[model samples]
Target: MREFLVEITTTVPEGTGQEEVDRRRSAEAARAAELAATGNLARLWRPVGELRSIGVWRATDEEELHEKVLGTLPLRPWMTLTVTPLESHPNDPGRLDASR
Candidate 1:
């Protein structure tokens, strides 16, 4: 599996009600938890001083990440996402076969 860094920035369109925003955020959290359980989502973080979040995702490739993961986000319509594929560092403590 390849790892990726995904940044998601969300905005409430002008005139959108707070209730709708709350509902979407709630559903987004639930969906993220489900993805984590299935190993598609590795980690999630909310950055300080920003209306954005970062997630570490594991997938076969970029196409799968887009089609099966990011595309399924509840807030996709309201979010601007940036995805970066990651390569394991030779010194990464979490990598079991770092020598390779």
Candidate 2:
């Protein structure tokens, strides 16, 4: 299956507290674990450098990748979901393809 990067963006409603955000994060983690159980999950990580955001790599087709990301988020009125294909790379690039 093709691998994709699923992006989960949350926009909390007005008057929301830190507790609610934590709760949503917890629920999202649980859902991610469920996805990981199956072959759909490739890897989960966060961005580095100046930007920071949780990233989940999932194996899915074009039509279903974004749909799968929806399951990773909580029920919120202002949440935005996005999915994009991830470029495949070797674990040890230095050891292979020395002809680069």
Top lDDT prediction, candidate number:
1
Q: Which residue pairs clash within candidate 1?
A: none
Choose the strongest candidate by TM-score.
1
Per-prediction CA RMSD (Å): 1.1, 4.6
Give the range where candidate 2 is weakest over 10 consecutive residues by summed lDDT: 50-59
Candidate lDDT values, in order: 0.90, 0.62
lDDT (10s digit) by residue, model 1, range 1-70: 8999999888879998999989998998898899999899999899888778998998999999999988
| Candidate 1 local distance difference test against the native | 0.90
Model 2 residue 15 CA deviation in Å = 2.1
Every model's TM-score: 0.92, 0.58
User: Residue 99, candidate 1: how far off, in angstroms?
Assistant: 2.4
Give per-residue lDDT, candidate 2, residue 65: 59
Residue-pair clashes per candidate, as listed? 0, 0
